[model samples]
Target: MFVLAAALAATLAACGGGGGGGGQGGEDVTVASDIAYPPFEFERDGEPVGFDIDLLNEVGKRAGFTPEYQNVTFDGIINGLRNNQYDVAISSMTITPDREKRIDFSEPYFNADQSLLAPGDAGIESVDDLGDATVGVQLGTTGEITAREFKDEGTINGEIRTFDTIEDAFNALENGQIDAIINDLAVSQYEAKNSDGNAEIIEVIPTDEQYGIALPKDSDLRQDINEALAEIKEDGTYEEIYKKWIGRAPEEIPR
Candidate 1:
């Protein structure tokens, strides 16, 4: 029962916590991740813990495979998947047309949009007002893509600094190296709230993006993953996990 215009919701609890190589299994699945994006996939106590980790663990259990998470850079993750370094990957990756040409995606798991995080006093109320203000973004992310769009469209005639992680982007903003950070709403908000008043979300850019797990093209695991995801939702496991992490049940998670 998936819908085209569904609203995204989330819940969560810590699951699949660890950072390193996967153990050999009958069907070994190496899941590549950036391991820095929070509320989705980030390291805690030197281990991975977040929504994607928890969800993927359950999906693997239902799909009859062992899942192992490998930490990789956001820009390098796709290539790693293509080269067979990873059996699959999930790190809050948005399902985009350009990406689909090289890989396969499971059903959309989370709905997301872009956001601008700036100092509380920046007077940047909307994306339209970003003119002449430097923006920081994580390299190889939709945030970077959107920032470039703003520059190309003349919405902002300022510098765009690319960082390896969202944390670095936020640090740049706090240190005045940049004026704003354009990132996913949930991520930006989480960062800002914990920034000790150094950052605040100023604008929401509606892009209607959906996050999906990425797999190598022609991989036989795609359908099984999809089926497991469906079962997770149907059995209410998704809701419980969403509530644990997102603090609320999904209103309309895709399918």
Candidate 2:
């Protein structure tokens, strides 16, 4: 069954999402993602559930692969794929030139930008005023890249502590371990609300980035995912999954 699934996925890859491949294999696809990124990807009811998960499940159903999730740090997801720790990565990953060198990316399933979050009363708002304060970020994310940018420019002088996950970064901020955290805007909002208003959005960094599924560079999975994604979005499945995790439709969010 597993072999059949691989062949199916491989065939589905080359032919576009026209129809089934040669076999109906049940080969499980190991999808590495950070379970702490709520709304995008996270744990709910002891199972992986989020917009990314749902979107990719639709992809799996259409493209013919059984997705089995593996929880890894957001930063390590790509490496996990390269190391064969997983077959695919659907972690709200952005397609960047730097990243493209390491792995291939599917057509953007979503678009988002890095956003800054902080304690409401801290008088620390925006990336500019973050000078000399501990900046928290989710390792392996565009958010981390944004934080590093601030540090490099001396806009933020304090330590840039990269947490294993966004939940931990937010926890650090809540516990006063860090002044603020950088994350995707919506997921950050979800975390803040789930924390009972302890965290607040400071600013959404103006990063024009599109989210894509990460696969090994030159891997056929990238093309297969993009083809499957196009159909899923067109079929209203994308809208359904978006509403399920994000609570509404996605608008044209200007970066």
Candidate 3:
């Protein structure tokens, strides 16, 4: 009887039983992110570090799971989640109606907008000045969507160059390969500050977008993560993380 009971216990453990939750049940959860986007998710010394990293780590602590981050491109995260290739994604992904149809999202965590970045001497003060210029954007990002909208409205007559990552777009802009770049405002500000005056934010385009923690559709972890996120915001931890990576206390916490 003792031998039979021990074998049964081992089998249950191997089958991921004995935990009182759905899915990972306090185990390591696979987290997908685009690690090149700074002030959000980026690598330092071969480890992920940024606002999204810090925030998600805290959420994991309260949600009774540990996140194992998987570095991937921004455009692939959604499909990866849809395919169950990743458990969660928090790469500064803005919550959108289209994406909500394909995946679930935690409560709003960060507010964002788009910005026009150009060389300081490029004379590109706004989107209106982008006529006949090469405008760079990260593929599958809200920035790219906004730029396309501008083109559709005849706001600019330019080549909308798409890059796999925002860093690549920034590099292209710095090297004079693209006349301007349209990307997230906070990220653009960080780049402009670190660019030694090479690039500057020419215009702040308000998109009224809010970022959220993304998960596979109907994920059981959603409630746990949302509860943890709410607690973090209520207890002032969110502001600390925000100020640490974003360089200022957020004027308002996203809902």
Candidate 4:
């Protein structure tokens, strides 16, 4: 079990941005998240709910703070973090070099990869079926990375349809506008489970990228967040949350 070693005072300080109006007794904090991504963060019955939402709520409880959620877009999470639009971003944001340059990341809270999904009747069983076929992806995402790789290898033909969001990408797939859509496995699983058996996760892509909480760079918050993240994993909170959402906990560090 990994233990969070930072001072408690420090962990609370990282959430020190945005309006401070949740009564004078508790420090006020606001979290920015792309609510469109389900099983991570999304709206359910007019309110945001998901694993990330629960995890952060627990973290706030343990750390002594109150959090306000702002439903922002995925493309805007990083910018919002940097611009001080929110205290932190919990949009299932993957830590990457391009993002690292602009903001800091909490220790990885979840490890997952993009998955490819196709229609059952499309005869698209594997990556081979995607060869010379028009693939779909969400703009500016790991799905786009997988699509480009397929295109470069000449396995994917036709134009790649880029949607502004994953929901749009899946909508395109269901309408037969594209052969398949690639996205995070957790998100893929959520779609499949909720699709009334209309969609399925055809293949799990092999990748090692992970999701982390995003914060502004050069802020003392980074150290504290990493500590809190480590604590969550060290305790049973991380695995507990995983099981509640996806049925099983993933191998923490990724193979």
Q: Candidate 4, residues 30-93: lDDT per residue as tens digits?
A: 7887788888888889878888998877776656657688886677777787888888888887
Worst 10 residues of 2 by lDDT: 16-25
- TM-score list, all predictions: 0.88, 0.85, 0.90, 0.84
Worst 10 residues of 3 by lDDT: 16-25
The positional error of residue 115 in candidate 1, measured at the CA in angstroms, is: 0.5
Which tens-of-lDDT digit does each residue in 150-169 have in candidate 2?
Answer: 77877888888988877888
CA error at residue 112 for candidate 4, angstroms: 0.6
> Candidates 2 and 3: which is better by TM-score?
3
lDDT of each: 0.86, 0.80, 0.92, 0.77
Per-residue lDDT of candidate 1, residues 58-107 (tens digit): 88887877777788889998888788778899999999999999888999
TM-score-based ranking: 3, 1, 2, 4
Question: In TM-score terms, which candidate is top?
Answer: 3
lDDT value, candidate 4, whole model: 0.77
Q: Backbone collision count in every prediction?
A: 7, 6, 0, 1
Ranking according to lDDT, highest score first: 3, 1, 2, 4
Candidate number of the best lDDT = 3
